[model samples]
Target: MTTLSPARALPSAAEVALARESSRTLSAYLQTRAETQQIEIVDDQGAAHPVRVPVSALRLLVDLLTEIGAGNAVSIIPIHAELTTQDAADVLNVSRPFLVQLLERGEMPFHKIGTHRRVRYQDVIAYKERIDVERNKVLDALAEQAQELKMGYE
Candidate 1:
Protein backbone atom coordinates (compact mmCIF):
# COMPACT_ATOMS: atom_id res chain seq x y z
CA MET A 1 0.00 0.00 0.00
CA THR A 2 1.11 3.55 -0.64
CA THR A 3 1.89 5.75 2.32
CA LEU A 4 1.91 9.50 2.63
CA SER A 5 4.28 11.50 4.79
CA PRO A 6 3.29 13.81 7.60
CA ALA A 7 3.26 16.74 5.23
CA ARG A 8 0.32 15.26 3.37
CA ALA A 9 -3.04 15.96 4.96
CA LEU A 10 -6.68 15.30 4.20
CA PRO A 11 -9.14 18.09 3.48
CA SER A 12 -11.13 19.56 6.35
CA ALA A 13 -14.91 19.52 6.59
CA ALA A 14 -15.23 23.11 5.40
CA GLU A 15 -12.85 22.44 2.49
CA VAL A 16 -14.84 19.38 1.49
CA ALA A 17 -18.07 21.35 1.62
CA LEU A 18 -16.62 24.07 -0.56
CA ALA A 19 -15.34 21.46 -2.99
CA ARG A 20 -18.78 19.90 -3.21
CA GLU A 21 -20.41 23.26 -3.84
CA SER A 22 -17.83 24.20 -6.45
CA SER A 23 -18.25 20.79 -8.11
CA ARG A 24 -21.98 21.28 -8.48
CA THR A 25 -21.56 24.81 -9.78
CA LEU A 26 -18.85 23.76 -12.20
CA SER A 27 -20.89 20.81 -13.46
CA ALA A 28 -23.86 23.04 -14.16
CA TYR A 29 -21.71 25.57 -15.96
CA LEU A 30 -19.85 22.88 -17.90
CA GLN A 31 -23.09 21.48 -19.24
CA THR A 32 -24.12 24.85 -20.68
CA ARG A 33 -22.67 27.39 -23.13
CA ALA A 34 -20.67 28.91 -20.27
CA GLU A 35 -18.26 26.01 -20.53
CA THR A 36 -17.15 27.20 -23.96
CA GLN A 37 -15.93 30.47 -22.50
CA GLN A 38 -13.39 31.46 -19.88
CA ILE A 39 -14.27 31.69 -16.21
CA GLU A 40 -13.55 34.07 -13.37
CA ILE A 41 -11.96 33.14 -10.08
CA VAL A 42 -12.97 35.02 -6.97
CA ASP A 43 -10.62 35.32 -4.05
CA ASP A 44 -11.49 35.05 -0.36
CA GLN A 45 -11.64 38.86 -0.29
CA GLY A 46 -14.27 38.89 -3.07
CA ALA A 47 -11.76 39.99 -5.67
CA ALA A 48 -12.66 38.53 -9.07
CA HIS A 49 -9.90 37.64 -11.48
CA PRO A 50 -10.54 36.49 -15.02
CA VAL A 51 -8.52 33.70 -16.53
CA ARG A 52 -8.90 31.63 -19.65
CA VAL A 53 -8.20 27.94 -19.33
CA PRO A 54 -8.37 25.14 -21.86
CA VAL A 55 -11.58 23.14 -21.86
CA SER A 56 -9.64 19.99 -21.14
CA ALA A 57 -8.01 21.68 -18.12
CA LEU A 58 -11.35 22.87 -16.86
CA ARG A 59 -12.70 19.35 -17.22
CA LEU A 60 -9.80 18.04 -15.19
CA LEU A 61 -10.41 20.68 -12.56
CA VAL A 62 -14.05 19.59 -12.33
CA ASP A 63 -13.00 15.97 -11.91
CA LEU A 64 -10.55 16.91 -9.16
CA LEU A 65 -13.16 18.92 -7.36
CA THR A 66 -15.66 16.08 -7.63
CA GLU A 67 -13.20 13.63 -6.15
CA ILE A 68 -12.29 16.04 -3.38
CA GLY A 69 -15.96 16.62 -2.67
CA ALA A 70 -16.33 12.88 -2.28
CA GLY A 71 -13.58 12.96 0.37
CA ASN A 72 -10.95 11.47 -1.89
CA ALA A 73 -7.35 12.61 -1.92
CA VAL A 74 -6.10 13.96 -5.21
CA SER A 75 -2.65 14.14 -6.76
CA ILE A 76 -1.84 16.02 -9.92
CA ILE A 77 1.06 14.65 -11.89
CA PRO A 78 2.55 16.31 -14.91
CA ILE A 79 2.15 14.48 -18.22
CA HIS A 80 5.86 14.58 -18.98
CA ALA A 81 6.93 13.43 -15.54
CA GLU A 82 9.12 10.36 -15.25
CA LEU A 83 8.01 7.60 -12.92
CA THR A 84 9.82 4.67 -11.44
CA THR A 85 8.76 1.15 -12.42
CA GLN A 86 6.84 0.70 -9.19
CA ASP A 87 5.14 4.08 -9.57
CA ALA A 88 4.22 3.30 -13.15
CA ALA A 89 2.83 -0.07 -12.11
CA ASP A 90 0.82 1.61 -9.36
CA VAL A 91 -0.59 4.11 -11.84
CA LEU A 92 -1.57 1.27 -14.20
CA ASN A 93 -2.95 -0.76 -11.27
CA VAL A 94 -0.76 -3.69 -12.24
CA SER A 95 2.08 -5.62 -10.74
CA ARG A 96 5.65 -4.56 -11.37
CA PRO A 97 6.32 -7.86 -13.12
CA PHE A 98 3.33 -7.31 -15.40
CA LEU A 99 4.51 -3.81 -16.24
CA VAL A 100 7.97 -5.12 -16.96
CA GLN A 101 6.45 -7.70 -19.28
CA LEU A 102 4.59 -4.96 -21.11
CA LEU A 103 7.75 -2.92 -21.40
CA GLU A 104 9.60 -5.92 -22.75
CA ARG A 105 6.84 -6.61 -25.24
CA GLY A 106 7.00 -3.01 -26.44
CA GLU A 107 3.35 -2.50 -25.48
CA MET A 108 4.45 0.41 -23.26
CA PRO A 109 7.52 2.51 -23.65
CA PHE A 110 10.16 2.86 -20.92
CA HIS A 111 13.74 4.01 -20.67
CA LYS A 112 16.61 3.25 -18.32
CA ILE A 113 18.13 5.97 -16.17
CA GLY A 114 21.35 4.56 -14.78
CA THR A 115 20.20 1.23 -13.27
CA HIS A 116 16.60 2.26 -12.83
CA ARG A 117 13.81 2.05 -15.43
CA ARG A 118 11.63 5.12 -15.89
CA VAL A 119 8.30 5.36 -17.67
CA ARG A 120 6.77 8.55 -19.01
CA TYR A 121 3.43 9.53 -17.50
CA GLN A 122 2.08 10.29 -20.97
CA ASP A 123 2.92 6.78 -22.15
CA VAL A 124 0.98 5.20 -19.30
CA ILE A 125 -2.00 7.48 -20.00
CA ALA A 126 -1.87 6.56 -23.69
CA TYR A 127 -1.90 2.88 -22.82
CA LYS A 128 -4.91 3.43 -20.58
CA GLU A 129 -6.74 5.23 -23.39
CA ARG A 130 -6.05 2.37 -25.80
CA ILE A 131 -7.23 -0.18 -23.25
CA ASP A 132 -10.41 1.76 -22.61
CA VAL A 133 -11.14 1.97 -26.33
CA GLU A 134 -10.55 -1.74 -26.79
CA ARG A 135 -12.74 -2.62 -23.81
CA ASN A 136 -15.55 -0.40 -25.10
CA LYS A 137 -15.33 -2.02 -28.51
CA VAL A 138 -15.63 -5.51 -27.02
CA LEU A 139 -18.54 -4.36 -24.84
CA ASP A 140 -20.33 -2.90 -27.86
CA ALA A 141 -19.83 -6.13 -29.82
CA LEU A 142 -21.21 -8.19 -26.95
CA ALA A 143 -24.25 -5.90 -26.63
CA GLU A 144 -24.92 -6.25 -30.33
CA GLN A 145 -24.70 -10.01 -30.12
CA ALA A 146 -27.04 -10.06 -27.13
CA GLN A 147 -29.54 -7.91 -28.97
CA GLU A 148 -29.45 -10.28 -31.94
CA LEU A 149 -30.22 -13.13 -29.52
CA LYS A 150 -33.17 -11.20 -28.05
CA MET A 151 -31.60 -11.16 -24.62
CA GLY A 152 -32.26 -8.70 -21.77
CA TYR A 153 -34.47 -5.62 -22.01
CA GLU A 154 -35.48 -4.03 -25.31
Candidate 2:
Protein backbone atom coordinates (compact mmCIF):
# COMPACT_ATOMS: atom_id res chain seq x y z
CA MET A 1 0.00 0.00 0.00
CA THR A 2 1.09 3.53 -0.68
CA THR A 3 1.19 6.09 2.14
CA LEU A 4 0.40 9.72 1.45
CA SER A 5 2.24 12.58 3.05
CA PRO A 6 0.57 14.40 5.91
CA ALA A 7 -1.56 17.45 5.12
CA ARG A 8 -0.10 20.48 6.89
CA ALA A 9 -3.04 22.86 6.93
CA LEU A 10 -6.71 23.07 7.77
CA PRO A 11 -9.21 22.93 4.95
CA SER A 12 -10.01 26.15 3.12
CA ALA A 13 -13.44 27.72 3.68
CA ALA A 14 -14.70 26.60 0.29
CA GLU A 15 -13.39 23.07 0.74
CA VAL A 16 -14.94 22.90 4.19
CA ALA A 17 -18.32 23.97 2.82
CA LEU A 18 -18.16 21.38 0.07
CA ALA A 19 -17.06 18.71 2.51
CA ARG A 20 -19.95 19.56 4.84
CA GLU A 21 -22.44 19.16 2.02
CA SER A 22 -20.91 15.85 0.94
CA SER A 23 -20.88 14.57 4.51
CA ARG A 24 -24.53 15.40 4.90
CA THR A 25 -25.35 13.59 1.69
CA LEU A 26 -23.40 10.53 2.77
CA SER A 27 -25.06 10.57 6.17
CA ALA A 28 -28.52 10.81 4.69
CA TYR A 29 -27.86 8.02 2.21
CA LEU A 30 -26.45 5.71 4.86
CA GLN A 31 -29.36 6.42 7.17
CA THR A 32 -31.99 5.54 4.57
CA ARG A 33 -30.25 2.63 2.86
CA ALA A 34 -30.37 -0.84 4.34
CA GLU A 35 -27.02 -1.79 2.89
CA THR A 36 -24.45 -0.06 0.76
CA GLN A 37 -23.74 -2.13 -2.38
CA GLN A 38 -22.27 0.12 -5.01
CA ILE A 39 -22.01 3.76 -6.02
CA GLU A 40 -21.76 5.65 -9.29
CA ILE A 41 -19.01 8.12 -9.96
CA VAL A 42 -19.24 10.88 -12.53
CA ASP A 43 -16.22 11.91 -14.52
CA ASP A 44 -15.14 15.43 -15.45
CA GLN A 45 -16.70 14.89 -18.91
CA GLY A 46 -20.05 13.99 -17.34
CA ALA A 47 -19.66 10.27 -17.86
CA ALA A 48 -21.11 8.11 -15.09
CA HIS A 49 -19.39 4.88 -14.07
CA PRO A 50 -20.57 2.38 -11.53
CA VAL A 51 -18.02 1.16 -8.99
CA ARG A 52 -18.16 -1.09 -5.97
CA VAL A 53 -16.97 0.48 -2.69
CA PRO A 54 -16.66 -1.49 0.51
CA VAL A 55 -18.95 -0.39 3.32
CA SER A 56 -16.00 0.02 5.69
CA ALA A 57 -14.15 2.23 3.24
CA LEU A 58 -17.30 4.27 2.67
CA ARG A 59 -17.75 4.75 6.42
CA LEU A 60 -14.13 5.90 6.75
CA LEU A 61 -14.63 8.33 3.87
CA VAL A 62 -17.73 9.73 5.52
CA ASP A 63 -15.88 10.28 8.82
CA LEU A 64 -12.95 11.93 7.06
CA LEU A 65 -15.28 14.19 5.12
CA THR A 66 -17.15 15.11 8.28
CA GLU A 67 -13.92 16.11 10.02
CA ILE A 68 -12.83 18.15 7.01
CA GLY A 69 -16.24 19.81 6.96
CA ALA A 70 -15.62 20.94 10.54
CA GLY A 71 -12.47 22.75 9.29
CA ASN A 72 -10.16 20.14 10.77
CA ALA A 73 -7.15 18.68 9.03
CA VAL A 74 -7.41 14.91 8.90
CA SER A 75 -4.70 12.24 8.63
CA ILE A 76 -5.35 8.67 7.58
CA ILE A 77 -2.93 6.35 9.35
CA PRO A 78 -3.62 2.71 9.97
CA ILE A 79 -4.08 1.89 13.66
CA HIS A 80 -1.27 -0.67 13.56
CA ALA A 81 1.11 1.59 11.67
CA GLU A 82 4.36 2.52 13.36
CA LEU A 83 5.46 6.14 13.66
CA THR A 84 8.60 8.07 14.39
CA THR A 85 8.97 10.14 17.54
CA GLN A 86 8.34 13.39 15.70
CA ASP A 87 5.26 12.01 13.97
CA ALA A 88 3.89 10.73 17.26
CA ALA A 89 4.59 14.10 18.90
CA ASP A 90 2.75 15.94 16.15
CA VAL A 91 -0.23 13.61 16.45
CA LEU A 92 -0.38 14.03 20.23
CA ASN A 93 0.17 17.80 19.99
CA VAL A 94 3.06 17.46 22.36
CA SER A 95 6.74 18.27 22.11
CA ARG A 96 9.13 15.60 20.90
CA PRO A 97 11.12 15.90 24.13
CA PHE A 98 7.95 15.37 26.15
CA LEU A 99 7.03 12.36 24.07
CA VAL A 100 10.49 10.97 24.65
CA GLN A 101 10.00 11.47 28.36
CA LEU A 102 6.70 9.57 28.18
CA LEU A 103 8.40 6.76 26.34
CA GLU A 104 11.26 6.68 28.79
CA ARG A 105 8.89 6.64 31.73
CA GLY A 106 6.99 3.70 30.22
CA GLU A 107 3.76 5.68 29.89
CA MET A 108 3.37 4.46 26.32
CA PRO A 109 4.74 1.33 24.72
CA PHE A 110 7.39 1.49 22.01
CA HIS A 111 9.91 -0.71 20.28
CA LYS A 112 13.33 0.33 19.07
CA ILE A 113 14.24 -0.12 15.44
CA GLY A 114 18.03 -0.15 15.90
CA THR A 115 18.70 3.08 17.84
CA HIS A 116 15.41 4.76 16.91
CA ARG A 117 12.23 4.23 18.94
CA ARG A 118 9.04 3.53 17.08
CA VAL A 119 5.51 3.71 18.46
CA ARG A 120 2.28 2.29 17.12
CA TYR A 121 -0.47 4.72 16.07
CA GLN A 122 -2.89 2.80 18.26
CA ASP A 123 -0.65 3.26 21.29
CA VAL A 124 -0.46 7.01 20.79
CA ILE A 125 -4.22 7.29 20.41
CA ALA A 126 -4.80 5.18 23.51
CA TYR A 127 -2.38 7.32 25.50
CA LYS A 128 -4.08 10.51 24.35
CA GLU A 129 -7.50 9.15 25.27
CA ARG A 130 -6.25 8.12 28.70
CA ILE A 131 -4.75 11.54 29.31
CA ASP A 132 -7.92 13.29 28.18
CA VAL A 133 -10.07 11.19 30.45
CA GLU A 134 -7.82 11.86 33.44
CA ARG A 135 -7.73 15.57 32.70
CA ASN A 136 -11.52 15.67 32.43
CA LYS A 137 -11.93 13.87 35.72
CA VAL A 138 -9.64 16.34 37.48
CA LEU A 139 -11.48 19.28 35.94
CA ASP A 140 -14.80 17.83 37.02
CA ALA A 141 -13.56 17.41 40.58
CA LEU A 142 -12.27 20.95 40.65
CA ALA A 143 -15.57 22.24 39.31
CA GLU A 144 -17.44 20.36 42.03
CA GLN A 145 -15.15 21.78 44.72
CA ALA A 146 -15.59 25.28 43.34
CA GLN A 147 -19.36 24.87 43.36
CA GLU A 148 -19.27 23.71 46.97
CA LEU A 149 -17.25 26.80 47.88
CA LYS A 150 -19.69 28.95 45.87
CA MET A 151 -16.88 30.40 43.80
CA GLY A 152 -17.88 32.50 40.79
CA TYR A 153 -21.30 32.31 39.11
CA GLU A 154 -22.68 28.85 38.59
Candidate 3:
Protein backbone atom coordinates (compact mmCIF):
# COMPACT_ATOMS: atom_id res chain seq x y z
CA MET A 1 0.00 0.00 0.00
CA THR A 2 1.17 3.53 -0.82
CA THR A 3 1.25 6.12 1.96
CA LEU A 4 1.02 9.88 1.51
CA SER A 5 3.67 12.16 2.99
CA PRO A 6 2.72 14.71 5.66
CA ALA A 7 2.78 17.51 3.07
CA ARG A 8 0.39 15.63 0.83
CA ALA A 9 -2.39 15.43 3.41
CA LEU A 10 -5.50 13.66 2.27
CA PRO A 11 -8.37 13.85 4.74
CA SER A 12 -8.12 11.74 7.88
CA ALA A 13 -10.74 9.00 8.35
CA ALA A 14 -12.98 11.32 10.35
CA GLU A 15 -12.54 14.29 8.00
CA VAL A 16 -13.33 12.14 4.96
CA ALA A 17 -16.69 11.23 6.53
CA LEU A 18 -17.39 14.91 7.28
CA ALA A 19 -16.51 15.92 3.72
CA ARG A 20 -18.90 13.36 2.31
CA GLU A 21 -21.66 14.74 4.56
CA SER A 22 -20.71 18.30 3.53
CA SER A 23 -21.02 17.35 -0.15
CA ARG A 24 -24.55 16.10 0.42
CA THR A 25 -25.52 19.31 2.23
CA LEU A 26 -23.84 21.41 -0.46
CA SER A 27 -25.82 19.67 -3.18
CA ALA A 28 -29.00 20.37 -1.27
CA TYR A 29 -28.06 24.03 -0.73
CA LEU A 30 -27.34 24.52 -4.44
CA GLN A 31 -30.78 23.17 -5.28
CA THR A 32 -32.48 25.63 -2.88
CA ARG A 33 -30.66 28.83 -4.06
CA ALA A 34 -32.24 31.31 -6.48
CA GLU A 35 -30.25 32.17 -9.61
CA THR A 36 -29.48 35.66 -8.30
CA GLN A 37 -28.49 34.34 -4.87
CA GLN A 38 -25.77 32.18 -6.38
CA ILE A 39 -23.05 34.71 -7.20
CA GLU A 40 -22.29 38.47 -7.46
CA ILE A 41 -19.71 39.88 -9.85
CA VAL A 42 -17.29 42.64 -8.83
CA ASP A 43 -15.23 45.20 -10.72
CA ASP A 44 -12.15 47.38 -10.22
CA GLN A 45 -13.25 51.06 -10.42
CA GLY A 46 -10.25 52.38 -12.42
CA ALA A 47 -11.62 51.44 -15.87
CA ALA A 48 -12.79 47.84 -16.30
CA HIS A 49 -16.42 46.60 -16.20
CA PRO A 50 -17.72 43.88 -13.87
CA VAL A 51 -17.31 40.19 -14.68
CA ARG A 52 -19.83 37.34 -14.66
CA VAL A 53 -19.50 34.12 -12.60
CA PRO A 54 -21.37 30.83 -12.38
CA VAL A 55 -23.46 29.50 -9.53
CA SER A 56 -21.10 26.53 -9.43
CA ALA A 57 -18.50 28.87 -7.93
CA LEU A 58 -20.96 29.56 -5.11
CA ARG A 59 -19.84 26.21 -3.72
CA LEU A 60 -16.43 27.80 -2.99
CA LEU A 61 -17.97 30.55 -0.87
CA VAL A 62 -20.29 28.21 1.02
CA ASP A 63 -17.45 25.81 1.71
CA LEU A 64 -15.80 28.51 3.82
CA LEU A 65 -19.15 29.11 5.53
CA THR A 66 -19.28 25.47 6.50
CA GLU A 67 -15.66 25.50 7.65
CA ILE A 68 -16.34 28.54 9.83
CA GLY A 69 -19.47 26.98 11.27
CA ALA A 70 -17.50 23.83 12.00
CA GLY A 71 -14.76 25.76 13.84
CA ASN A 72 -12.18 24.83 11.27
CA ALA A 73 -10.96 28.34 10.44
CA VAL A 74 -7.56 29.32 11.86
CA SER A 75 -7.83 30.59 15.41
CA ILE A 76 -6.28 34.02 15.96
CA ILE A 77 -4.32 33.66 19.18
CA PRO A 78 -3.51 37.00 20.83
CA ILE A 79 0.18 37.70 21.14
CA HIS A 80 0.16 40.35 23.86
CA ALA A 81 3.74 39.25 24.54
CA GLU A 82 5.97 37.49 22.07
CA LEU A 83 9.16 35.51 22.48
CA THR A 84 11.64 33.84 20.15
CA THR A 85 11.05 30.11 19.63
CA GLN A 86 14.14 29.43 21.74
CA ASP A 87 12.75 31.58 24.56
CA ALA A 88 9.34 29.96 24.20
CA ALA A 89 11.10 26.59 24.42
CA ASP A 90 12.63 27.71 27.70
CA VAL A 91 9.19 28.76 28.89
CA LEU A 92 7.90 25.37 27.76
CA ASN A 93 10.75 23.75 29.73
CA VAL A 94 11.98 21.83 26.72
CA SER A 95 15.21 22.05 24.71
CA ARG A 96 15.46 24.53 21.82
CA PRO A 97 15.94 21.64 19.39
CA PHE A 98 12.80 19.94 20.66
CA LEU A 99 10.83 23.17 20.21
CA VAL A 100 12.16 23.51 16.69
CA GLN A 101 11.12 19.91 16.10
CA LEU A 102 7.59 20.81 17.27
CA LEU A 103 7.52 23.78 14.88
CA GLU A 104 8.81 21.66 12.00
CA ARG A 105 6.27 18.93 12.80
CA GLY A 106 3.47 21.57 12.67
CA GLU A 107 2.61 20.91 16.30
CA MET A 108 3.36 24.48 17.35
CA PRO A 109 2.23 27.80 15.89
CA PHE A 110 4.74 30.54 15.17
CA HIS A 111 5.38 33.40 12.84
CA LYS A 112 8.60 34.04 10.95
CA ILE A 113 9.84 37.58 10.68
CA GLY A 114 12.84 37.62 8.30
CA THR A 115 14.41 34.38 9.53
CA HIS A 116 13.52 34.25 13.23
CA ARG A 117 10.43 32.41 14.45
CA ARG A 118 8.38 34.00 17.22
CA VAL A 119 5.84 32.31 19.47
CA ARG A 120 3.11 34.01 21.44
CA TYR A 121 3.23 34.03 25.24
CA GLN A 122 -0.29 32.57 25.27
CA ASP A 123 0.80 29.68 23.07
CA VAL A 124 3.72 29.09 25.41
CA ILE A 125 1.33 28.90 28.37
CA ALA A 126 -0.98 26.52 26.59
CA TYR A 127 1.87 24.29 25.45
CA LYS A 128 3.21 24.11 28.99
CA GLU A 129 -0.22 23.26 30.36
CA ARG A 130 -0.66 20.46 27.82
CA ILE A 131 2.73 18.92 28.59
CA ASP A 132 2.19 19.20 32.34
CA VAL A 133 -1.23 17.57 32.08
CA GLU A 134 0.22 14.59 30.21
CA ARG A 135 3.16 14.38 32.56
CA ASN A 136 0.89 14.31 35.60
CA LYS A 137 -1.20 11.54 34.10
CA VAL A 138 1.91 9.41 33.60
CA LEU A 139 3.19 10.23 37.09
CA ASP A 140 -0.15 9.24 38.57
CA ALA A 141 0.00 5.91 36.79
CA LEU A 142 3.56 5.35 37.98
CA ALA A 143 2.54 6.08 41.57
CA GLU A 144 -0.29 3.56 41.30
CA GLN A 145 2.09 0.96 39.93
CA ALA A 146 4.60 1.69 42.74
CA GLN A 147 1.81 1.07 45.29
CA GLU A 148 1.04 -2.24 43.61
CA LEU A 149 4.73 -3.26 43.61
CA LYS A 150 5.27 -2.00 47.21
CA MET A 151 8.32 0.04 46.18
CA GLY A 152 9.31 3.75 46.44
CA TYR A 153 7.21 4.18 49.60
CA GLU A 154 7.26 3.14 53.28
**Local distance difference test scores for all models:** 0.83, 0.87, 0.65
TM-score of each: 0.66, 0.88, 0.45
Ranking by TM-score: 2, 1, 3
Model 1 weakest 10-residue run by lDDT: 1-10
Clashing pairs in 3: none
Residue lDDT tens for model 2, 12-118: 99999999999988776565344454789999999999987766677888899999999999878888888899889988989999999999999999999899999
Instruction: Name model 2 segments beyond 4 Å from true.
Output: 1-4, 32-35
What's the residue-level lDDT of 133 in candidate 2? 100
Off by over 4 Å in 3: 1-79, 152-154
Q: Top model by lDDT, which number?
A: 2
lDDT of 2 at 138: 100
Candidate 1 local lDDT, 1-154, one digit each (tens):
2322233367888889999999888776566454355789899999999988766677888999998898877887787788888888888889999999999999999899788888898899999899999999999999999989999835
lDDT of 3 by residue, 57-112 (tens): 65764565455445453222235677777667766678999999998887778888
- Once model 2 is optimally superposed onto the true structure by TM-score, how far is the C-alpha of residue 33 displaced, in angstroms? 6.5
Give candidate 1's error at residue 77 in angstroms. 0.2
The CA lDDT at 59 in model 3 is: 70
lDDT of 3 at 15: 67
The true-versus-predicted C-alpha distance at residue 120 of model 2, in Å, is 0.6
Model 3 lowest lDDT segment of ten:
1-10
